[model samples]
Target: MKRIVIIGGGPAGYEAALVAAQLRADVTVIEADGAGGACVLSDCVPSKTFIASSEVVTGYRDTEEFGIHSDGLEAVTVDATAVHERVKRLALAQSADVHSKLVKAGVTFVAGTARLGEDTLGHTHRVVVSPHGSDSEYAIEASIVLIATGATPRVLASAVPDGERVLTWRQVYDLPELPQRLIVIGSGVTGAEFASAYLAMGVPVTLVSSRDRVMPHEDPDAATAIEQVFRARGMTILNNSRAEAVTRVGDGVEVRLSDGRTVTGSHALIAVGSVPNTDGLGLTEYGVTVADSGFVPVDRVSRTNVPGIYAAGDCTGVLPLASVAAMQGRIAMWHALGEAVVPLRLRTVAANVFTDPELATVGVSQNEVDDGRVPARQVMLPLAGNARAKMADLHDGFVKLFCRPASGQIIGGVVVAPRASELIMPITVAVENHMTVSQLAHTITIYPSLSGSIAEAARQLMWHDEE
Candidate 1:
């Protein structure tokens, strides 16, 4: 049996372990955190759970518009502590579920920090695991080593998290009470998500954007819509402002901007970005190439320069989505174990920003088209034109499709609506299979549905082709 060792137990690590084990390979997963890593135990699961609570509050507040009147609406309030308690409970349970799967797959689980080392012969790879809260160290020699150590939230020196007033994305769940006025720095996905959730929960939120607009990486149309929604909900957006420092003031925190201005709030969340957890792993010593930012360099097949040492997930500096991480992990295992595998195609990967009226995208983006990287025809159908959206009181987004002008093949698409995450799947499939716009238009879609907008967008593209 081929022995495989996976470092880190996040989506990438755990998924790789299970795949390797099922292939009848001896698999071991060494993780410093608990099983499920930051995605499940800290970042993704916790934040989504918190967002769910905010979503419930938003639904209740919108009930009157739906012709439902209830006396409880006026008195409804979020218990920050209780909400966090549920978040923690759900995260732990999900972690336990991943652990259970790993156990059932006959994969050895070790709670420890892992480092790369050479075997006694100095020819094969070996992992030295230093167990958490203990000094006992053990080494596991393996034919293949997969690095999936994931990443941690990047923090500025001036905005150090105190776990009380100033916070990182991971530290938010531990709060004892909700902030009366919350300031979220950085207008990327993480920053926008928290700002939206808190605003929906009735917390006064100020979003500080270093760029001129929020989510600078997203399509301009989608970003504009989200910004409009945010401002419409009483959110104070500081555009073209950069946060220089965060300091405690009496009962709140003051964020000093680069332009000689300051914004004070009861608490501040630093959602700048993330740093990959690839340091101190002896990667350089093992002849593995690591980028200056501490992310491992890997190819499409998830292989590092050092043969038999593959890296996946956030540590590899690929797209940081959990789904992409899992795919990379599986591809790494399949390649290493001599199984049939396909190299990762990033264009087909779908991503979602979990805010109110989520923004989901797949295939080519509008920026790509504008930059002349992707020559395509584009069409957008407003959700307001959809019967279901009108009935559901949802009218903040659209479905945009990008297709090859000559052949009408669907190349990419974006969905900006409630549950855009789900709506983008069909578009993603169409892009993946190189399906034509006509095919998508012909696909049966329920009338009066958001997906109908997708079909409508495709039909619009078909009309453009005819013209």
Candidate 2:
């Protein structure tokens, strides 16, 4: 039986353990953090839970839009402490659940940090597990090793998180009270998400964007729509401005911009980005090529340069989504264990930004088309034209489709709407399966649905093909 040791209990490590166990490999997972890693324990699950609460707060504010009248609407309030408590409970519960699943799968779960080293003969790889807060260490011989240590939130030296007045994305959920004025620096997905969530909860939010627009990496149209919504809803956005330094000033925080301006708020969130948690793993000694940014370099199959060693998750410099991490883990196991495997095709991956009227996209994008990287024709259908969107009073988003001009094959799509994460699935499927616009247009969709807009976009693409 093949012995496999996986470092880090994040989505990638745990998922690979399960797959390796199913393949009858003797699997052991060494995780310094609890099971489920940061995704469940702190970052993704916790932030999304907070967003879910904010969505409820938004729903209460929109009660009148649904033709429902309630005298107590004015009395509705959000309890920040209670909301945070719920987020913590849900995160912990999920971590425990992942632990249970790993145990049930018969994968050995060790609560420790792991470093790669050579065996006695220097012919095979071995793992040294060092339990947290302990000086003792033990070594395990492995035929295969998977590294999925994940990442940590990037913090600028000029702007350090005090975990009080200033916070990182991971530190926000533990706050006892919501900030009256929340200033989020960095208009990437993390910054935008927290800003939008806080705004929905009735907090005054100021979003600082170093770029010209929020979510500069996203579809331009989608970013514009979100920015419009933010401005209309009373959220302040400072574009083309970079934060120079953050300082605490009399129970409040002051963010000095590069332009010699200062913005003060009750609390500040530094959402600049993340750095891979790849340090101190002894990877360099073992011939693993780590980038200057500490990210491990891997092939499409998640293999490292050294034989029998693979890397996945954020440490591998792949897409940072938990789904992508999990898939990379599975792919690593299959490829290393002599099983048939498919290399990751990032184009078919769906990514979502969980803001109000969530933005989700799959496959190629408009920028790619504009840059001439993808030879595709595109069409966009407004959600306002959909019956369900009208009923829901969602006038802010659109469904855009991209297809090959000659064959009409669906290449990519973007959906900006409430629950856009769910709505982008069909587009992802179409892109993955190489479905054509005509085929998508022919599919039956329920009346008065957001999905109707997707179909309509495809039909429009079909017409464009004809023309």
lDDT tens string, model 2, 1-467? 99999999999999999999999999999998799998889899999999999998787666677778754335668899999999999999999999999999999999989898754465457889998788999888998999999999999999999999899999987788899899999999999999999999889999999999999999999999999999999999999999999999998999999999999999999999899999899999877888998999899999998888999999987899999999999999999899999999999999999999899999998899999988999988889888998898888999999999899999999999999999999999999999999999999999978999999899888888778
| Model 1 stretches with alpha carbons more than 4 Å out | 71-74, 119-123
Candidate 2 minimal-lDDT segment of 10 residues: 67-76
Q: How much is 275 displaced in model 1, in angstroms?
A: 0.5
lDDT of 1 by residue, 1-467 (tens): 88899999999999999999989999999987799999999999999999999988887766777788864445678899999999999999999999999999999998888999853465468888898889788888889999999999998999999999999999988888889999999999999999999999889999999999999999889999999999988999999999999999999999999999999999999999999998899999878998999999899989999888999999988899999999999999999989999899998999999889899999999999999998999998888889999999886999999999899999999899988899999999999999999999889999877899999999999988888
TM-score for each prediction? 0.98, 0.98
Give the range of the ten consecutive residues with the poorest summed lDDT in model 1. Answer: 117-126
RMSD after CA superposition, every candidate? 1.2, 1.2
lDDT of 2: 0.93
Clashing pairs in 2: none
How many angstroms is residue 407 displaced in model 1 relative to the true structure, after the best TM-score fit?
Answer: 0.3
- The TM-score of predicted model 1 comes to 0.98
